[model samples]
Structures are given as C-alpha cells and as structure tokens.
Target: MPEKTIAEFSVKYVQVMDEKGIADAKLMPRLSDKQIIEMYRLMVLAKAFDDKALKLQRQGKIGTYASHRGQEACQIGGVYALGKNDWLFPAFRENAAFIALGFPMHLLYAYWGGDERGAKIPKEFNALPTSIPVGTQLLHAVGTAWAMKLKKKKSATIVFFGDGATSEGDFHEAMNFAGVFKTPTVFLCQNNQYAISVPRSQQTAAETIAQKAIAYGFEGIQVDGNDVFSVYRAASEALKKASMGNGPTLIECFTYRLSDHTTADDAKRYRTEKEVLEWKKKDPIERLRKHLEGKKIWSSRKEKELIDWANEKVEKAVKEFEAMPAPVPDDMFQYLFAAMPRRLREQRDYLEKYVNELRREKNG
Candidate 1:
C-alpha cells in the first residue's frame, strides 16, 4: 500500500465522520444517543416537509416554495449548536433551520401560503421573520448582537445566508461592523456551489469565502458543510467563543444545492442532471446513516419509524394550512401601518366597494 499523505494547509476545525463512513473518534463532537437520534429524525422530517411543499406548490395549494433538500445537515447542525437564548436571523431559504429552532410547521406553511400570521413567530423564540431580500438579514444579526453587548447580555447571534449573498453590500457592511465592534456573531455561509443559476466561480474570485473574515480581524474556518458533525462542532465552538467576548467568527460551510432554487426556478436551464447525480454520492444524511449503522445505533426498523412519523406530521400540517380561511383583501393594507392613513383608508374602501359590486353583478 502507498503511504498516506496529508495536505499541508488543511485546517479542519472539526469533523466527526468522513463521507466514506469513516469516523474520527478524537474529533467527533460529544452527543448523547438521544440527541443523535433527534438530529437524524429532524433531518428526515425537514426533507419530507420540503418534498411536500414542492408538491403543494405544484398543486396550487401554496405560493412559490424554496426547497431545502440537500441542505438539511447544514441547517440542523448550525441551529442545534445554538443555546436556547441565542437569536437566529435567517434568510428566506431557512425553513429547516426555523423548524429546528421550534418555529411551528403550520405557521411556516401558512407563511408560504400567503398568510401574514405565519410571520409572527412567538416573541419568546428569538427567531426573526424570514427575510426575502437576500443578504439584508446579515445586518439584522449584527444589530441584534450589538444590542446584546450594550445590554450586557450573554448571547450570540447566528445569521444564515447563501454563497451568492456574500457579494451583497450588506454582507460586507455586517461583517465589518461585527469585527470592529467585536460583536458576538457567527456569519455562517452555506456555499452550496450555486446562487440561483450563478455558479460559485462566478460569485467570487476568492479561493475560500471563510478567509474573508481574516481580512476583517476575526478568525475564519472552513468545514464540510454536509457533515453534521463538522457543522455542529464548528458552530458550537464559535458560539462559545462569542459568548466569552472573544469576538465574532466566520464559518463557510461547503455544501451543495440539490434542488432548484425554488418553485419559481428551473435549475435544468442552467445545470445538468449529471451534476446533481454526482452530488448524491456525498449525501449528508446517507453518510451519517452509514456511520450510525456501523456503530449499531441505526437499523431498518428505526428508519421506517422516523419516516412514517415525519410523513404523518407533514400531512397534518398540510391539512391545517389548507383549512385556513382565505385572507381578506383588507388584511394587506391593515398591517402596513399601525393606524391606516386617511388616504389609504379611502383607497381600501373604494377597492372593497368595487370588489363587492363585481361580486353582486356576477351573482345576479
């Protein structure tokens, strides 16, 4: 056999299992058996919800949906690493992360189904509303962390974004401010190789996005985003460091986007089936499953149990979302301001009257 070789520049912060079902006993993060089982179940549920949402969009039951198929591990691992008090500022694509953080599945589906109530997360949860504008949430995370510092609170904020978002001005401004202020924040970028149709190479010329943090006066690390163990360990350490007032850290999770950008996108127009098939070889869930099986902690019976439970839960959420009463047209205008303006009220009344007149004419 040939001698084993290691790369000179390799700096893996933490990785418990390799893609080939190999385990690193020394580096694996300590997780109880119950915690491991829960993580596995959550990932399965996330994927099931993603699939059901796509079907709902196709059936006209929901508005455009973003699928989190291959990105389950990244979301679960990162969110699981947070303390109960830590705040989560998420981009629109983080359905799985929100669910992992205890956001109700019914509310999440309702939000995508065009209901404003879906945006109202319980204030006690510390999760912000899903931000549709790509990189804007980064700023919110930085601001929240800054506030915590001012209030002398011991909490850090984790903001999730895609590779394409790093090009946005808000991404840079947020990082710069966080570094300068030494705010307790973690900039977790899921570099899934493509930002919509744009490839990673076109997104930036930087060899590694994590290295950008070094320029901003903080530590930066890259990890296998698909490896749950890697993401959990890195995020846990980063959060701990921030809580200790050591300042912010940037973590680049190298993963892949296995599905179309959203229901509104056709990835085939820009990518190939062959590329997606190749990525399946690195499936995070499968890799972890194999490792668990090796430890005799996973079996066919457990797999079936989790799948059945997830499917039933998702089915129930769908029924609830569908049963919701249609939103009144006036609801759109009502939430825009605390008190409706006179002119706006007049416009709303006029529109309501016109709609009622049309309805009467049709009925007659």
Candidate 2:
C-alpha cells in the first residue's frame, strides 16, 4: 500500500481581547456587563491577595509563598467559569482560584502561615486543599471526575497545575486515564513560561501543552491566559462539555509570571528584565480596564474605588487571620484519625514533655 497519513491535528488558539484592549467582537464570549465586571473584580481581589501575601512573607509573618501576579486572568477567569457543584482541584499557587471559588481570604492567609486548619475546606465548597507536589492533584481530580461519571452526576471536575507539571509521570497517567474512561474533567495548565528557574522551553519539546491532549484522545485548546475573556470563554466551554458527558479537555493558558516564582526565589536570576517588561505590556488587569474604559463604564475614579475596596477587604482578612489563635504542635496528632494510635500518642506525649521542659529552662 502507498504511504498515507491516517490523521492530522492542530491546536486552537483563543484570544478574544488583545493586549492593546482591542477585542474581536465576533469571538467575544456572551458575557453580560455585570458578569464582565464581576470577572474584573475577582481578578483585582486576587491581585490584592497576592500583594498582601508577598508583603507578609517579606516581613516574616508568613512562610514561603507563591505569587500568581500576572496570571490572575488565568486563575480567576477559569475558576469563575466553574459551576457551584463542579469540584476544583488546585495545585499550590492557585490563590486566585480559591478566591474566585469563595474560599475565605482569612483562611487562605492562615494556610500560608503554616496552619493546617486553614486548608480545612468547608462542606459547602467542593474545592480540595491545594497540593504542593507537582502533578499529583491531576490524578485526584480525575478520580473525582470518574466518580461523578459513575454516579451520573451533572458536574465536572477541574484541576489546575503549572506548565512544569505537564512533564511529570502523573500528568500523563491522569490524562491517559481520563481519556480512556472519558471522564468529565478539565485540565487547566497555567503556562507561566517558567517553573522556578527552569523555563517552559526546557520543560517540553512539544510546540504546545494543549497538543499533548491529542495523544490522549481528547481535545486541547490554548488561550491567552492574560486575557480574561479568552480564559473564561475556553474554561466555560470546556466545563460545559465535561458536564454534558462529552469527556475531557485540556486548556493551556499561555500567561506570564510577573513576580518571582515565590517569595523565596528571584526570577531575575534566570529571565531577563526586558522579557518581563514585554509581558507587563500585556497586563491582564490593565487590558480589562482599558476595555471597560472604552465601554464608558470604568474611569480613574472607579479604579480608585475598586482598589480601595479590594485593599480594605484584604486588610480586614489579614486582621482576622492574625487575630486567630496559633495552632498547637499537637494539632497534627489531633486530626489524623478518629482514634489516635498508641504509637502516635506516645510521640505526641514525648513532644509535649520536651516542649514543656524547654519552656521551663527558658523561664528559669
């Protein structure tokens, strides 16, 4: 037989609004004015949270923290598109997702401060506490999605991870499983260009992360992660498809990280300032502000009011978080199981006695 190609595939790139605030009307999502502003507010709130968290880390009030600075559009836009019942599985650095899902900012602050109780998600919210290890949450999301499918539920499961995670074994396993099983899951990858010091170029040789989905028998689409409209539209569509039992989709949000990888790492060591400056020109919030300005619904006064409101809310949450009592070392032993094991009990008692002895010595 003559050589022939059986199949061909190409990834779709979505960008409803360009960095210059020019929007393609035909491609714009059918979002109302209220919904658009709500998306904008959520992004602003995420920025407020990121700013305060970074400052807290610098002042020694919080442990090492990740800043989702320039990727607010990706996080907030994708998360805001989720239905109330859709479960959200987030990797660490999904502050905006948590905020959009109505996770209390005070509890978020507490979590970053190293208190485990902060991550104890409320019963009403279907979000899982963000995992710190790369790519692991994808499996968990797939499992929940499979369960939903098994139960004939009408909700999808969405999982968020970074670009670096796509290279992990778990990413492939989850994608393959979800694809074979046709699970109602959405994989949201925030391609912020770098994973810590490693750039995206080093993470994978593939042209786009979304294309990886093709290998798993699913659809994958890339979107301008900095453009809120594109992110929201893609996520909304993917989630709807998942809930409707159409199987999985991968959304690779092409965004940039304006801040360092975390409070502890300096991005300037690896990437160029000029490169970052260029991405800053594509600032998501500013682009949205310009679009709103064109619509005559936003002005400097409104911007100021919004900023003031966001800052006030963040400050209030910070105060509430600080006012909460500190977590005891015994807290770890308290929550593990319904009944504490004898071995763990012995360890907890030993720790208590050692701590008390140290306290006495310091006092004396």
Candidate 3:
C-alpha cells in the first residue's frame, strides 16, 4: 500500500474554473450547491446596488459614493468566510461585504446620503461602523481581537483595508501588535491595484502585499481577488487558524477597481479606457456565471430571473430610503457628544431662533 504523503506545496491562486465548473479538485473549497447559488445571488445584488448608488449620486440623491463594481467577489468572498460570531472592521469601499453580512441596503444608501444613523449596525450583527480614514480601523480590529483573546472567546476578527492603506502607520502598528500578541485576527487586504489615481506600483515596492506578513512573523498568501472560490478558501483557512489561536494571517486578494475611486473622481484622467476595458474581461460575475453554466445549473432564464429580482429589491430599498423624512439640522448636534458642550448648545439655540425668526418674517 502506498503511504499517503502530506501535501507540501502551497495552494495555487485559483484563476479560471475548469470547463466542468469544479474548482481544481485539489485546490477547491468544499462549497455546497446552495452556497454557490447564494454567493452568485449576493454578487448580483451587490452589483445592482452599486449601479443604483452611482445613478443616485449622479442625480444628487446621495453624496459622492464609491462603487465596488468589479470587486464584488473579493469583498463578498472574504466576508462570507467569517463565522456569525466573528467581527468585521471595514474600510469605506466595502459596500458589498457589509451587504453580504446582513447589513440592510437602505442603511448603506442612507450612509452615503450623509446620515450618521446609517453607520449603526444591529446589535445582533458583529460588524463595526464603516471607517472613513484610511487604515485607522485596522487598529480597532486588532484591539477587538486582543480583547477576545484576553477574554478567552472563540471568535476571530477580520479587518478589510485597501492596498493604499498598507503604507499607513496604523496598518504597521496593527500588524505588529497582532503578531506580537498572537491575536486571533485575519487581515484581509483588497489590493485593487489603485488608491484613487495612485497605482499599486507607486503604493509599495514589495513584490506582493501579502508577503509583508513575513516581517510580522505570520503566514501570508496571495489569491486571485476576482475568483470568489479562491478568496473564500484563503480567507476561510486564515480565519480558521485565527480561531484556533494560531495568530493572524495576511491574505491579499489581488483585484482591480474597474470604476472610478468614487463618483466624485474622474478615473479617465488617470487611467486609459483600454485598461478599464481589459479588466472588464476579468469580471468576477462572468467567471462564476461561466462555471455555473458548465454545471448545467445556470441558464439565461435563471440569470434574467435573478437579475430582475435583485433590481426590484434595490428599487424598493431606494424608495424606502427616499421616503424617510428629511433630517433636522439639530440632529447633527445630537450625536457629537454624550452631552452637548455649552458653546455648541448656545450655537444650536441661536440657529433655532434664527430659523424661527426668518420663518416669522416670511409669513408676515
């Protein structure tokens, strides 16, 4: 009888799925048919929300918004790997990730529409409020993981940040602390190749962002960011390790941002149309759709049905967001502190009086 040798090589970064729709049998995640279908549906819903948000921003319904257009697989795949008890600390561009984790679409839209209430996640969910300052949330995630370790909890923490954030001091500090303390955390960096107009080459000189984990004494792996299977497997493995007290793992999902950094920026000024066109060929949804087709489960009819359902859901959310009453000016002051400072209270009172006086004059 032949001795079963333990596999010594690293997992290949999955790219195209075989024509049979099975992940390379040796490198695949053990995903169920129901899970695959759910992943695909979530991806479609995310893309729809992104499109609608962009449209709303253009029409001035929302403030400047970021589109996670081509990076759905990376975001969804990474977040879906976590257990319900695990926590998520996200950067600004992870709309799909939050949505996949049960965040209401209307809350997300409301956040972009400039309502602070949008940042509030339900107590039942372990997601943190979205962090806008780049790289700052990494520290918070590390702290949470550290606390969990001290409390002897079984959960892990996942922090999502962009490649550009890797250059920040907070990123370094978080990694260093997680490594030194052996905290249960996974640092998921979505290296989408650009930070606003700045390309990855300009962001760092390292061969790969994941490789940076070596400096912190942890394992790191780079996976195809556009391949949901690869992203999920990598993240899941890292998360499993973290949950078992193996410390942190850095997983870099190599992907690209196919749209402008945000609605406020003009990507055309820095990137060529040809480059965007080229990346479009690597569309995450198309890869999954092709794989599903190969399995004979995905058809044009099914695709249309799913898309229509997603569109209707998005439209309904939009209506709900729009129907909410206009926010009061005083509402902004309410959350700034546990109790308003005297100066702010004076300003609030003065503004209220001024508005009332103006209304009276107009009525007269």
Q: Which candidate is the best by TM-score?
A: 2
lDDT of 2 at 196: 96
Ranking by TM-score: 2, 1, 3
Q: List pairs with backbone clashes in candidate 1.
A: none
Candidate 1 residue-wise lDDT, 201-294, digit = tens: 9999988888888778888898888898889999999998997888999999988989899999999999989999988888888887887788
Candidate 1 wrong stretches, greater than 4 Å: 1-14, 334-364
Query: How many steric clashes between backbone atoms does each model show?
Result: 0, 0, 0
| C-alpha lDDT of all candidate models, in order | 0.88, 0.93, 0.89
Question: How large an RMSD does model 1 have?
Answer: 5.5
Native-to-model Cα distance after best TM-score fit, residue 344 in candidate 2, in Å? 5.5
Task: State every prediction's TM-score relative to the real structure.
Answer: 0.91, 0.95, 0.91
Better lDDT candidate (1, 3):
3
Show pairs that collide, candidate 2: none
> Regarding lDDT, does 2 or 3 come out ahead?
2
lDDT (0-100) at residue 315 of candidate 1?
Answer: 95
Superposed model 2: Cα runs more than 4 Å off: 333-349, 359-364
Pick by lDDT: which candidate is best? 2
lDDT tens per residue, model 3, 7-86: 33342355435323555667778899789989999999999999999999989999989899889988999888999789
